[model samples]
Target chain A: MPNSETMAGTSAAHSEAMIGLYDVHKSFGPLEVLKGISFEVPRGGVVALIGPSGSGKSTILRCVNLLETPNAGTIKVGAQTLAFSKRHRLPGDRRLADFRARTGMVFQSFNLFPHKSVIENVMAGPLIVKRMARDEARAIAERLLARVGLAEKAEAAPARLSGGQRQRVAIARAMAMEPDVMLFDEPTSALDPELVAEVLAVIRGLADDNMTMLLATHEMAFARDVADRVVFMRDGVVVEDGPARQVIETPQHPATQAFLAHFHRR
Target chain B: MSGVSYHWDFSFLWGYRTVLLTGLAYTMAYTVGTILLGLVIGLVAGLMRMSRNPFIRGPAFAYIEIFRCTPLLVQIVWFYYAFPILIGIEMSATTAAVLVLSLYTGSFYAEIFRGGILSLELGQWDAARAVGMRQGQLMRHIILPQAVRRMMPPFINQSVIQLKNTSLVSTIAVTDLLYQGMLITAATYRPLEVYTLIAAIYFVVLFPLTALGQYVENRLRYAE
Candidate 1:
């Protein structure tokens, strides 16, 4: 048997999958949302999950962050791994929190805290969750807000900004945590057509910086442009997975072909 | 055809001003005290009602319902008489009055708070949790700030109502505004003048607060 030191060294060395989901299963009452789904996102890789509405695309992203607990699976992010079964008990609140702190999630509604000024919203997670010092967090927040092109709007309230600006602030807020992996669940789906471009630009910037990301999005063009790999899912299962060019362009599976055809027609 | 009248004397009010003002001070103390205590109770009870644990949620739900359903006067009088017997600790009439009144006001405030919290979109909760905020941090930093803003107008309105409810404490001999006014009326045999003055004082205090509540409600009416 390998010693504890060797095991730790092995996991540290070979943990290329920054985020992984193995046979994740989820159900709400009688309806199964995710059925034995599996995926792995390597370090600094960009994976876009594209699928129809009920295909459990968002559920997979949420499960990676443990927002939704799966009935059966093993989720690995960096060195932290959680194994789930029918009666799986969560390890501890502290461990789960530490796991979550290493992964950042962006939502569809761009949920910037309405009561906070834009800069404070960006600084909140680091200051509150990570317990960072105020000046350091504020400096990081200022730089991030600048990176997202909202430096001038730091003191403004969320109500004063456009939907795209709010989403960008949300991205900056998530980036403040400096996570090992980022999850985007329909980030641009709620924005106006013109506004979507601004938000997508910031996301593309993250990809340029080699941020490991998992995006569940409808923007096929943006997905193709930014993603290293693309996974096509339908009815709680992955229908196709390959290079972004082949999956979006060639689409060998009939389901993939149909899904892409619908997108093309639109 | 004769309206019962002794010629009304506005002159006596000047002499009685200190008495009336002293009573006003007591009323103010009671009002502020009840508001602080009531708000603390309402916040705890409101959060307890939201708890998933049956043990906590059930008691919180029952407390809100019981106090809200009973009359404030009855609750106060019951506490004044029964509390010493039940708890084996005699409380002053003023103490009993304040305790019962704060509790009564708290039930309504709890409902107001609960409604404010529920009114927020579930998305806010999700977004906060997604960012690695623990449940306590999320409620404190995200949910409560927004909910408290929404709870403000109603909370102020409840304060006004509780101020008026303090009039009930006169029955327990607390010598509040109403009680002092009653004493002056008996001493001078001028009921209309003294009672009218008392009514006007209540109006003076409460009208501004009600108006402030309206202003806050208007300001908070944002596109949620």
Candidate 2:
């Protein structure tokens, strides 16, 4: 019950939500990406959202940051509800840039700026978004890179790093933003099986530090191992949500059990 | 006699070396200036063509299409002569050359820049967005820098073309290198020797640029 209480408390914090979505809908011509997607993430907790491919998990994550405009919805991040629609006429809002300043994301493909060294990539957020002094950002970037065990590779271009190392650098880039919460969009899904362990380890370290996180991933084992709560999604709706152990072990919903059965085998 | 005599005097080019040298400087200055301006306009226009809003998107696409369909020489002349006639504004031959050259090169540069940025793995855009970046941030931070590595060759190539197009400015009396060469040929009786010297100077200037382009292509490929 305390777990549900925690979730409710997390949801209640939506009065000035760190991130919130309500009745969001998105369509690309005839292809619908989000169908009334609604959820909220509070200040500090790890919420793992699992769903089938094309279930709009990534879209939902993107909409939170206004990367993808939803056709109809209200998204609030930290007392500010972003306006997103197919036809709204506001352009070049620098405040939106500032809002994203306090939020960061680790991507599935480790989108490190290929031209920049690992440290430069890490420094990009603070330098560009936060307007931190270059030298200061560089110093802190090295520390963040070190935190992810990439200190030696600070001067290395991301192309020179291995898949896992690049993803860790991507994580460091996000962390350097000093965000309130970090969003991860399948951060390890692109890695080789062996490399996944290293990425998962860096992520585990972030969890250990009690950083608030929202991850959309299919790594059920990872969900069970690190996630505080698991949300099973189907057809763009949350089907079942509970503690990782219970949800993965004795899923009540038919969809959840079926999903776990497939997940357990592999 | 034509083969043996060569009907050429080299003295004219040597005497007018100052004219040729000044023309060369203007050529390079014109090329470098337009290439940078063209690249900036192309970068913005290319992204605008991809914009989400139709109002923002349509004009960029239309502008690029119209310019791309028109010949550079015609555009140059149009800007040089017709522009003043149509718009009641007069620009000098040099100014007109630079303005038309930038617009002409910008349309082609837009294609190269857009293609380079687009060639990036689709996941790059997704990754940028997931970090809470707007399209501008995504372009400036993620896409532009990465695209640049692939873009250097074509961008440099456009500059080279801009350099070559400087010859076209001679028609408008801009006194570019090619025009100066022609002027020397007219004043001097030795067409063979004067034209040969001009060709050598042009080769001297262009060969290094072409080599640099090749070097850049190799470096970017190796980085990948």
Top TM-score hit: 1
Instruction: Candidate 2: list runs displaced more than 4 Å.
Output: A1-13, A16-18, A83-92, B1-13, B122-138
Model 2 over residues A224-266: C-alpha lDDT tens digits? Answer: 8898888777776667777887887888888888877997887
- Which 10-residue span in candidate 2 chain A carries the lowest summed lDDT? A1-10
What value does the lDDT take at residue A158 in candidate 2? 83
lDDT of 1: 0.88
Q: Cα miss at A109, model 2 (Å)?
A: 0.8
**RMSD in order of candidates:** 4.6, 3.7
- Chain A TM-scores, per candidate, are 0.93, 0.90
